[model samples]
Target: MTAIAEHKPAPPKPGTGGGDGGFIDLVLRFRELTILAALIVLVAVTTAVNPRFLSAQGVEDIFLNASILVLLAVGQTLVVVTRNIDLSVGSTVGLVAFVVGDFVTNSDHGLVVAVALGVGIGAVCGLVNGLLVSFCGVPALVVTLGTLYVIQGLNHYIAHGEQISAAEVPQSILDLGNGAILGVPYLPLISVVVMLLVGYYLRAYSSGREFYAIGSSPEAARLAGVPIRRRVLTAYLASGVLAGLAGTLWLARFGTVIADPAKGWELKVVAAVVVGGVAIVGGVGTVYGAALGALLITTIGSVLVVLKINSFWQEAIVGLLLLLAISADRLVALRLARVLRKRNARHG
Candidate 1:
């Protein structure tokens, strides 16, 4: 009888059904699960200390407070996943909020007009940053940092130290921000909708996968014919558009706008994204994880107040969590790489 030849199956691609793909999916899910567990434990401990911490209203408040940050964090994830950053987002939010708020306050523009104006302004800002970083060859960090200051300065110049008060905001806008359906607040509901939509797109589309590929290895992605400039521009634009929407929501939620309404918020958004398991060096993360990170961070602040802990401790705790997340991500990446190498060797 002729000798039979054995044929081994080829290794699965990075995002396919088996091998590296499965392992990566597991790790990503685990990161989100870890954050969810921490959130649960935190709520349990806080509720134990103060039962009111878990009250219906208190729970609603937590979601409500996290809504804006969650939106910002989701936006940031798009850019970070592409190995880029937008430090101007906070300034963008502040500028959009003030400009939109002022326009609505002074004009008879309806909600649609207000929203469009906000989004348009944000897109313009994103366009500027994208052009500089993607086409002009400027570093993302440097471009966004420069735009951050420029936007802040423009906001200050326009505001002239003026502020938009609750009395000036339209009741309709306020309702959109504060009203609810089925006992859930509108702010949180809107945020959740956006998060779900984005998460789906990123997971289900080829373009979405390209973002990860570009972040993972830019040279490889380029070699594979991915449109690097277009994708990066799209990421920045998405982030800007979301920041604009968040600004509109901010105005509605607070019925107030100042020149520096979202000052220093960019750092918090970065922290949330990092803590949510997004690798700082880029290429791995999800909007779901980023949203959970925002919620967890927001909850921590609330917990500290409810537990009567020093406000100062809140920053320290967040910093510690940030460090832990970075270290964990680094270790996990190294280990996963090693495992994959070993597995491939054995297969060979």
Candidate 2:
């Protein structure tokens, strides 16, 4: 009898199927689910304590307050996912806010034009940081840290201790902040659209996958034919654009802008992103989670006020939540790593 040649089965991809892959997927999916559950619980508890918390007006207030931070957190999530950080966003927002205020007060610019200009300026600042980091081979952290000072200084010089009050802002612009659509605040609605766009891009696009790949393993992504430099630059540019957009929202919401607009906001933004489940080391996270995080933190602050807790507890509570988030991240990471190792061993 003639012997027939037998075909061998193809090996599974490193991050695919039947072994550690399933476990990893389960863990990641669960992490996101858990975060959602936590948010729901928090909302329920707060509403229970103060029934007014569930009222339409109260809900709108919470969302509106979280809107700017949500924007910042989303941008921060992208940067952090690429294993980089943008420390200048707070300052960038401040600079853009001040610039918009100046245009409105000192010039004859319309509200729409001023908003566009502010966002445009923010994009430019982000572009500068991206170029320095991507082309100059500088660390993102360092580049952004420097830009923070530069942007802040520029804001101060431009404002020259000047402040723009509500009177200076056009009624139309201020209205943008308070206006609602189908019972939803305009700011939050805009924020939701932004988050949805970003979520779809990251989850459904090839370029978005490349971002996760680069974050997962930069050298490997390069080896796999990913355009490392181009993607990194684009990531930073997107971040800047988002930051600028956030500044416009900030200007509208506050109806005033000063040299110190959004001062110390970067930390809060980062914290929100991290606590929302974005990995600090990169290659993992969802915008939905980050948005949830922003909501959670915002709610916490509101809850404190409603509960008549001292304001000092706000920082302390945030610190505690941050610590818990980091700890949880580490535990999840370790578990995933262990599962991977075991599967590799079994398959080999």
Candidate 3:
């Protein structure tokens, strides 16, 4: 009289070409898809509310408005992909931007040189951040936070209550920012080119993927001889350079500069990156997605305008979107942890 034992189902395992893994991949892609859908819906709703919202000029304004954030978002994507953050980007942009007034109005340098100076200054700030974080073994958040204050202090000290006015700015440069080529604003076009190039690198290069590896598992990445420090430093440097570049463009677009220009943009850029679906935990998002995230944020503001939402509610909406993104990231982490545990159980 033998008793038959019941067979138990196998535990689901991630990376086994199984349904669970496929679902995770879908989740990763879902963020981008959601952004696209939201963009379409926002545009549709806004256009319905105000048909002029879809006007060609209005569309151009949206893209140009998003360009700076998009640049910062891409740079942030690089850093975040490696489990790092650069809180100094906004301050860096501000500091470099203060220089734009000097260059545009005081210096003999043309637009190109002005832009180069901004980038170089940004790189220096980045170098300070990178060296400290990599060689000093400081936590990235703390290091960036420290740099943020240092840079902001420097900005205020240098400005000493000075401001860069539109009359002092070159009309040529301002026109460059506003001018469209084949119907696309220059700023957005520049951003589009940058996003495409960065996206390609991340998608196609082995070294680019190293950023993800480091973020996915720093210990494992170190063991694999992935040169984690170098990658992380490079990420921060890239962030600085982009932020600086954005600063130059910012001056061009606005024709005005103050000591604290872009002072609050650091949070916005980080929010854009995270909301764009680049995992704050690192190694799971794209520059295009980040750019889309920037576009979505910008669109939200426009949507509010079209719908005549209270100005007070704008900040709340952005904050709520950011919170939602953070929550989504946390949920993704929990899902991954559960999958990893199941995989372990299957093996055990």
- C-alpha lDDT score of every prediction, in listed order: 0.86, 0.80, 0.82
Cα lDDT of model 1 by residue, 190-234, tens digit: 899999998888777878877887777777677666788999999
Going through the candidates in order, what is the number of backbone clashes in each?
0, 0, 0
lDDT of 2 by residue, 8-60 (tens): 22222222222345665566567668767877887798889989888988887
Which candidate wins on TM-score?
Answer: 1
* TM-score for candidate 2, residues paired by index: 0.91
TM-score of 3: 0.91
Which runs in model 1 stand beyond 4 Å of their true positions? Answer: 1-19
Models 1 onward score TM values of 0.92, 0.91, 0.91
Report the CA-based lDDT of candidate 1 relative to the real structure.
0.86
Instruction: Compare candidates 1 and 2 on TM-score and give the better one.
Output: 1
- Pull out the clashing pairs in model 3: none
Deviation from native of the Cα of residue 78 in model 1, angstroms: 0.7
Worst 10 residues of 2 by lDDT: 8-17
Q: Considering lDDT, which of the candidate structures 2 and 3 is the better prediction for this target?
A: 3
